[model samples]
Target: MRMKDKVCVVTGGSSGIGEAIARLFAKEGGQVAVVDVDEANGQRVVDAIRSQGSEAILVRADVADEAEASQALLGVTQHFGKVDVLVNNAGVSAVGDVAACTPTDWDRVMRVNVRGVYLMSHFAVPIMRQQGSGTIINMSSTIAVIGLQARAAYAASKGAVLALTRAMAADHSHENIRVAAILPGTVYTPFVEGYLKRHYADDMEGAVETLKRRQLNQELMTPEDVAYAALYLASDEARFALGTALIIDGGVSAAKVF
Candidate 1:
């Protein structure tokens, strides 16, 4: 058990990559807190973990809200005593170029993807500092480093996350707090499925194939893949991996597909 007796908090843990991370952490012996705004799905994940005879709890929170973020962390502490790992996995996306994006839409993206990370970390860090050790794994994207069509706001938010991760690592390393970000490529999550259905209504299959081809391996990255990377970053095994942008993008960033 890599995380035996540790307490881990995973935001947006109701579905997709977040749920995968919560489950994996529990299986590895962490007392997991599945935090999300969806009560039904969050409880479902918690129930599943308990059914498997592992420890887990559900925390309902809107990560972009500072008050809610603080309360969520408080809930975790009240139940599990302290936080050993914090995974900021909650995020929302926007589809538009800079000119096409309205100010409101841009703010929404920043609130969830960038501000959410800050809120979670701001509250969780004090607890970690008190304990003299902690780990933070942020969910970034391949688009943060590479240009992607119709994702200007998303790219900006995730790029901020990468910078935030490094800045936090530098600020807190002396206190034994490790901070890092995971850059995943196009993953096959419910969100992606819906996105494909909406944007590629007439040619969903073709669009999916086009996306797959963009990856050198020609396959969509799974939620589990990113979850496993989160697990490594949260565990003692990745003690030396602080401030790193760990890329799991199937070589997309390295290859030129033109």
Candidate 2:
């Protein structure tokens, strides 16, 4: 019941980490808003949450678009009366070193991963300020702190999110607004599975094993693992954790395997 009666808006909530967060929040007694561009899956998640006797609504939106982002927030506040938690979890990834990453690909990644956070926070902050309390969780990545093989664009975008989280905390913590970032490492989401299929079509198992090796536990992290971290941050228990980059990376950024 950590999130009891809290109004949570989870972007990208149709699947993966975002969906996990939405469901967990609802199970904890929070009224949830599932925001995503995939209307079908979004509706499915909302229906399932309701079937379990939890409150949830699907707000279809592409977080990268300012108009859509603003409308999405408006829809949530209209339905829920206020936003107690805003999870900026929607993001896109690109694979390449700087030279290999095209300008178009770089912009696309920035739009969803960086600008999406900015737009969502821009709208959510004022609402929270008026409410006199709220929590904002931005989804960063371990790649933001350490270099990865071919994640130049993604790394850059997440790093921006981390920086923005700190800046936001500095600006709003005194106002009872908590802004924090979650740095998760290689969660086994559909997005990652798709990446594996595209690049390692003939050796999916090997690719997955390689991913596990990067973590100290030698096991892939799950979306639920990250959702739990978000749950902590969004709950009142984390009130003292302002501007925190809660790392749930299974020790990936803490040490080298060698």
Candidate 3:
């Protein structure tokens, strides 16, 4: 019951890490807002949460769009009365080195991964300030700190999120609006699966193995693993954890085996 009665908005909640966070938050007694552009999948998540006797609503909107981002926050607040937690988890990825990454690819990644966080926090922060308390969790990545080949655009976007998290925390921690970022290593989400299919189609298993090798544990991280980290940050227990970049990367960024 760590999140009991908390009103949490999880962007990208239709699937993968975002969906995992939404369900886990509900299970812990939080009222959940599942925000995503995929209306069908988002609704499915909401319905399933309700079936389990938990509170949830689906807000269909693309996080990258200003109008939609603003409306998504409005819809959540209207239904829940206040937003206790905002999880900026909606993001897109691009695969390429700087030269290989087209301007179009770079902009698309920035829109969802960086601007999305900015827009959501821009809207959520005022509401939290008004309420006198809230937690904001931005989804960064281990790639923000460590080097990863062919992830130039994604790395840039996540690094921006980490920087933004620190800046937001400096601006708001005193007001009781805690802002933090989670740096998770390659979680086996649908997004990652799609990446494997697209880039490593001939040897999907080998690709997954390669991903696992990057982590110290040699096992792929799951969405639930990262969701639990978000749960910790969103809960009152993490009140002292302002401006934290809670790394849940299975030692990927911490050590290397030679």
Candidate 4:
């Protein structure tokens, strides 16, 4: 019960890493607000958490939408009374390098990955400040430090997240709001699957092999691995840690694959 009686909000909570985080948080006795634009999936998460005898509510929202971001947080606070942790995990990624990526795609990534974080924090920070204790966990990527040839949009967006995490930590340290980001490498989510499908297609299996071969570790990281990382940072145990770029890259970020 590390988070017993805490109120947590997880963006992109419908599936993948976000879903994993929400479930884990609930298991630790936190009341979770699962926010996502997909009502069906979001409700499924809420029901699943509830079935486990944990408290949860589903808030359907597009993380990229400012109005929706505000409404969702307000709705959560009104329901739960206060926020103890915010996990800014919603993001969209497009495949294309700087040379091939369009301005629209770039803007889309920024709006969701970067601006959405700001919007959520804008509403969440005040609540946390009043409470005198809060944690913000932003999801970044290993690509922020590495050159992922065709994922310029994602890299740029995550890079911004890393930067923003640091800036927010500095701004709110005195207010007792701790900000941190995680950089996960090569997570096998629908986001990565889509990239493989579109980019590799017939050669997808081979691409996966290549990716594994590139990994120093034998296994591809799961959403739970990242979820545990989130749990650690969101806990009271990690209160002294701030503005940290917690890397869960499994040594991929440590060596040169090329």
lDDT of 1 by residue, 1-258 (tens): 898999999999999999999999999999999989999999999999999899999999999998999999999999999999999999989899999999999999999999999999999999999999999999999888999989899999999999999999999988999999999999999889889898899998899898899888888889998999998999999989989999998899987766
Name the candidate, 3 or 4, with the larger lDDT value: 3
For residue 134, give model 4's deviation from the true position in Å.
Answer: 0.7
Model 4 per-residue lDDT at 29: 95
Residue 20 shift from truth in candidate 4, angstroms:
0.7
**Cα TM-score per model:** 0.98, 0.98, 0.98, 0.96
Judge candidate 2 against the unseen true structure and give its global Cα lDDT, from 0 to 1.
0.95
Ten residues in sequence with the least summed lDDT for candidate 4: 210-219
lDDT of 2 by residue, 1-258 (tens): 999999999999998999999999999999999999999989999999999999999998999899999999999999989999999999999999999999999999999999999999999999999999999999999888988888999999999999999999999999999999999999999999999999999999999999999889999999999999999999989989999999999898888868
RMSD after CA superposition, every candidate: 1.0, 0.8, 0.8, 1.3
Find the 10 residues in a row with the least total lDDT in model 2: 249-258
The per-residue C-alpha lDDT of model 2 at residue 54 equals 96
Q: Per-residue lDDT for 165 in model 2?
A: 98
lDDT of each: 0.94, 0.95, 0.95, 0.91
Answer with 1 or 3, whichever has the higher lDDT.
Answer: 3
